[model samples]
Target: MEGRLVLALILGVCTAIPCHAYYSPSKPYVPPTEKVTQLHFFLHDTVSGKDPTAVLVARPNFTTAFNNTPIPFGSVFATDDPLTVGPNLTSGVIGNAQGLWASTGQDVLNLVVYWDFGFTQGKFNGSSFSMFSRNTITQTEREAAVVGGRGEFRMAKGFAKLKTYFADFSTADAIMECNVTLIHY
Candidate 1:
């Protein structure tokens, strides 16, 4: 009985001994940086010459400093008009455009441009614009003149042009202050 009791005590002590396993906390992951080469804005008229006519009340607004520089993440660009019924009779045209340029960081970049037209009381009638890649712009220089000439119809025939190049993003501001000449011919 004495020997059995001693063996049981030894077994209990062995079982009570603690053993530890290895573990490690995870490290946060981060992405690399990219560079932007160029950004350009182009305006165009969608309606044909037979539609309503329009005139330009303001010239094109632009930023040339970053024209040939590298744009980092979180970069932004914005434009607005505070005139009342500048072109459309019922409401005014207000717009804001923003962009970011990156290289290897991420293959895709998000670009948003918004326009509101309706009444001063927060009512929106209608508006139009577009979003696209920069590399797809074939005729960069002629895009402005082509769109400017088409602006003859005011909002009735106005359109926004956007094109994203390799690592650059661009947007044209909303064209305002133009007479919509009705065609009866």
Candidate 2:
């Protein structure tokens, strides 16, 4: 009887201790290894030109104040904005920021964004990093998470900081500077 009780207690204690889900009992556990890299670029978003980079895709009809606010709640925009080496649009295009943004706040420019910065013309060609964030947009800066990626950025994870370089209210256009750093293979 004491032996039976002792065995039950040992089993209970073993189950209570946590074990990593990815770890296997048959194989030795080794930490994942990766390399780090940094990228600097600028994204140009234009709404007024004949060739617009970002456009309104969806808008909530239920919101009575939709037309009153610059960026009404529930409004969604899709973007294929060009990523340039410099803040100016005339600069060389390195890649494109393919993303979607939805205005989630009633007052402020708060947005939920899913963006993929795909590099095409540079050394990081064919590689991309994705970010999903609840961003509170400001005139100064904000940050978003680089969730995961593929190609040269396989298993990538990091953060991207965006600083507003220029904003033209009349045309509803903006130039944002992005600095991305990530750890990947």
Candidate 3:
């Protein structure tokens, strides 16, 4: 009778401990590994005149930046007014962006970037990736934004480090180079 009681007590303690879940008897546990990718691209920004037809009077407004076309106030898409609306923009060819006025109490420029990597070769041949980032850009280098991408970059998250290549203030045009690194499953 004493041996039976002892055996029952031992079994109860073992079940309560959950030792097998932590240290499996069959195979050793291994930590998860992360896969990462890095890329570099150039962003050319051109600030055009405000849209006169736009109904909103907000301090910050939306604008478009064309890929490989660095003209100020010009877009890749067709539009009636090039001076105010720039050009009409298409998917994978434009960055529908907005910049808040410094007087509006925001230090950085909010940008929604749609990068067209379609012309390139290799793994990302025809994928269009987008990122929403804040730019506190200066004359020197800085980490301007945290970027999460779509399409080929699905489920991938990363940061963007950028430095100004050149800036032409008179024309409201600038060239910035960005290095992006992402980690995913």
- Top candidate on lDDT is 2
lDDT of 3 by residue, 1-185 (tens): 99999999999988796645765456766745666878665554555456421122222224343222222121222112111111222213323223221211122332323332222344664443444544444345766443444556655666767777766655445556667677754
lDDT of each: 0.29, 0.85, 0.44
Candidate 2's C-alpha runs over 4 A off are: 1-32
Q: Which should have the higher TM-score, number 1 or number 3?
A: 3
Cα deviation in Å at residue 184, candidate 3? 2.4
| Between candidates 1 and 2, the TM-score winner | 2
- Candidates, ranked, TM-score: 2, 3, 1
Name the runs in model 1 displaced over 4 angstroms: 1-93, 98-124, 135-185
Q: Which 10 consecutive positions of candidate 2 have the poorest summed lDDT?
A: 63-72
Best by TM-score: 2
| Candidate closer to the true structure by lDDT (higher is better), 1 or 3 | 3
TM-score of every prediction relative to native: 0.19, 0.79, 0.45
Location of the lowest summed lDDT over 10 successive residues in candidate 3? 78-87
Residue 10, candidate 2: alpha-carbon lDDT:
95
What's the number of clashes in each of the models?
A: 13, 0, 4
